[model samples]
Target: MHDFSHCQIVLGSSSPQRKLLLESLFPEANVRIVPPDNPDELEFTGSKNLFAIMRQLSQIARTKSENVTSQLLDPTATYVLTADTVIFVPDDFDTYLVLGKPPEEDRDGVVRAWFLDHYLGKTHHAMTAICLRVPGGTVHEAFVKTAVSMEVASEEMVDWYLSTGEPAGKAGGYAIQGLGSIFVSSIQGSLSNVVGLPLRETRELFERVVQNGDS
Candidate 1:
């Protein structure tokens, strides 16, 4: 395991999953939470093209990092990390649709429709963009995509899952690490990516930033 005992991580998202993951990844480091000033500023609505979606995710993460870093009184003493995740489903026209967190208004209706129309018995990509700003203002950014396949869920199953209220703030209207795990039949990439942050990729990014900073 890479040692981060001497570093401090300033998380720029309010996501509980991300916070837990970061703590697990850097157990010895002091992790601080500093959510973006304007959470809504991370909202992205644009093209469905896979490449375009990837670019947008990266941009969103970078913007989030900038927003949070600006609030830090001593950024040079800590690493600022920000990330964004989304679900992308391919459409009939060879394009993709980006699915973000379910809207608060009629969240149940929205999640129910997502399960019936897009997720159950289908495969979708969970993409997470990570932006890590190391000391000295150097920033490293990357995105990871994981293909998640869901089992065919019956109406009753969907209703039961919805009752758990676990999909409200999650992308694609599901949380793979929670009760929603019962619906995931298989996954093709980083499981952490589906949860929110890609552990291996994120670790590598942090290491690269630190190495470059040292050299």
Candidate 2:
């Protein structure tokens, strides 16, 4: 286990899943929840390439870290970690579907219909960008891609899951770590990625910064 006692760790996210994972991974670390004010997630929309999307996510992480650190004084001994997760499915020859969180009001059922149409009988990618910023102004970042295959869900199953309100704020209308896990047939990469954070990659980045004495 890495010793995070040397400095305070600030998590720049409001997601409950990310918080849970981070705390579990670094139980001894002094983790603080200081979520950024604005995520500004819609910066890149015209690009259909997966790399472009991942890069956009990295940009969001950077922006979020800067937003949080700006509020702290003498943050030289603090490490601010920010992350973003995106789910995408190939739509056609040259485009993909970037699933956003369901609309809050969702008065017309568009969000619910979108969830049912796109996720059934499909394989999609979950890309997560994790960035770590040190006091020395060094930002170490990486993105992990996980391929997930979901079974063709019955209408009844979708209705039941959606009625629970679990998919409202999730990226792809499904939470692999929650009630939505039953719809997943297989996953080719880190399961943690589907849950919003890649554990191995996160540790690797933390260790890299620690080894370089940047954390």
Candidate 3:
């Protein structure tokens, strides 16, 4: 494990989940929370193709890192981290539907329908693209995909969950770490990935950066 006690970590996101995850990763490090500028401005314009969507997710994370790094006075001396996550819901057709956060306006209707129709009793992949901009300007990127299965939920159950207000800003209209966990039946990969950041992969990426910096 790399000791982050002496390092400076700049988290380029407004997500409280990611902030808490990063803090857990580097308990003693100086972690600065700098949200990206115009975060909603960068939209995903990729195709429904899975590979292309994954690439676009990584690009979005990279863009977030760039947005934050541009605000730093000494980018060469600090490590910057940013991440983007989406739920890949398989449709009846051959292609998959990419589900980001639900629209703020229709949390009651859209989110309820999503849980009842697309999410409940269905397995979706939670994909998170992580970008780490190490000191000296080199950027390391990776994506983690986890299969998540949701138990069948009734309309009343979905409505009750919606009343909790946990689905508003969550991808796929649910948060795995919150009350939403009741809906998750199984997960094939890292649970942390579904939460927002994959710890093992993130640690590996940071170690790789440190090794390269030493070389």
Candidate 4:
């Protein structure tokens, strides 16, 4: 557990990966995972309008952060963090088909096979919307983007990876931090963004919020 003696930060995500990233980055800070309040129907559009998408994501992140603040936080909490992740491709694609974590890991084999046949030789954008609510009750946010390329994975190879169950419950049907890294031909931006959270930008936003906070 991280030390919460001084300040508090609540992470608005139930994802294990996001929580892990927070723990790794703020070893001496307090952290808690809060589920997203947005409905499943809420869509995240990213990397196209860049600015527009980021603005919208910041809004959503702010909304989610405020939800956490109003629902599950203490009066002393110094910060509340929320994030949203999205994947973009050239053509119309399935989000669950790409990024949704499976209900049953047994489907990982099928998912890997499907991904191997389709995602090879393609580059896609991974966008993360990170929001931080400060002690003064204001929201600070940022959008992080990363381009990821998948190699030509064979069906047998996909099946092998699927058997390992790494694709289950992972966004874009793969885990960049785990065995899924093998299929990545290249990553043009923040590698951690593809994994889940973008620590660099998130931290910068936090610093800005703290520095410019209402006095």
Candidate 5:
């Protein structure tokens, strides 16, 4: 059993990468992981405006967290978290499929391959929406964005990369934190955000939740 020390931190996803990312800060056993009943959806507005898209993801994250928190309310439960990540190309993308982990063909349906082709050699934004549901009814949220530059990718390169199977379960077609890191040339914002969560912003939110001491 994990220790429920200090405050109970519930992560609403079962991604080992996310768990590892969080543990990088609090160590294993410091946080509790909770998977929500339904996965949060990532939607894009007609505009490729990063800020607007971030706000949309934030609202959906808040709703998901609320739904889970309400169901698992311990009355004394400390904190519950829900997050979503999206990637948008620069120049107001106007044409990128905001992605999540690609679903298995058997379950996820056919995901268009063109989205990956369009993202190559372009700068993209990774936005993470963090929702902290504290004791009582107060809810806190934060959104962070990171800029990523894809190395000039060849059709052969994308094909080879896809063969590795790492992109299948990542928000973006490429995972900067995995074998796909080779596809990136430079990153201007939070690296972790590109991976799915932003550490600095996440830590700040953690402190705020700790100080608020709701439950």
Candidate 6:
């Protein structure tokens, strides 16, 4: 198993997929769970620059790490890990259509339908930013970008997917690791990123932290 014997790892996310992925990666380590008191709320009204998106995601992960760390009994012996994922689709106007979890306000199928109508049979990028707050207060971070091609779905298929109530809290109104997998044509990068974490990069980051005695 991957070595992280020196640190008490706390995963700061509520996504089941994220938890499962982390558990599979560090089966030997006892990873704890600490969901954020408040879910992240990002405003998507600006330009979809890659740098800007990465920065925002990194900041969110950093904040989550800090928040989770504050709750630990001994912050000096814990490592809090957090992550955020976003779906990026470029529009025809030389801009991007960034998608996160559908806002709580869009209870109707407006947002969900919009995503399915446009994103189905299209190419998009899924970016995930991960951060680890070491016991020494040093934060290690990384971002992974994956190119995903979605399959074209018929109206009935789209309706069925939406009816499952799985898209409400997912980026791009879909989850690649669940029933949503059937809607994906191909993925060119880290599948774990689309699932909400980048396994390879996350493991490498943890190894570096352990090697440097940051944990």
Residue pairs of candidate 2 with colliding backbone atoms: none
Put down candidate 1 lDDT per residue, 100-215, tens digits, no spaces: 88889999898898888888899989999999888778888898999998999799999999898888888888889989999989999999999999999999888887666641
The clash number for model 3 is 0
Highest-lDDT candidate: 1
**What pairs collide in candidate 4?**
98-172, 99-171, 99-172, 101-169, 102-169
Where in model 2 is the C-alpha error above 4 Å? none
Overlapping backbone residue pairs in candidate 2 total 0
Q: What are the per-residue Cα lDDT tens digits for candidate 3 across 1-215?
A: 66667888999999898888888878734999989977564555554778888878988898899999999998988889999998888765767878778898877898887787788898889999999888878788898999999998778888899999988888888899999999989999999999999989988888887776731
All candidates: TM-score: 0.94, 0.92, 0.94, 0.78, 0.83, 0.90
lDDT of each: 0.86, 0.81, 0.85, 0.70, 0.70, 0.81
Stretches off by above 4 angstroms in model 5 are: 1-5, 40-42, 45-47, 73-75, 91-97, 101-116, 212-215
Following a full C-alpha superposition, what root-mean-square deviation does model 5 have from the true structure?
Answer: 4.0
lDDT of 2 by residue, 37-77 (tens): 77566555775887678778888888888898887776676
The deviation in Å at residue 108 for candidate 2 is: 8.2
Structure candidate 5, residue pairs in collision? none
Q: Per-prediction count of colliding residue pairs? A: 0, 0, 0, 5, 0, 0
Q: Who is ahead in lDDT, 3 or 6?
A: 3
Whichever of 1 and 5 has more TM-score, that candidate is 1
Q: Distance (Å) between predicted and true CA of 85, model 1?
A: 0.5
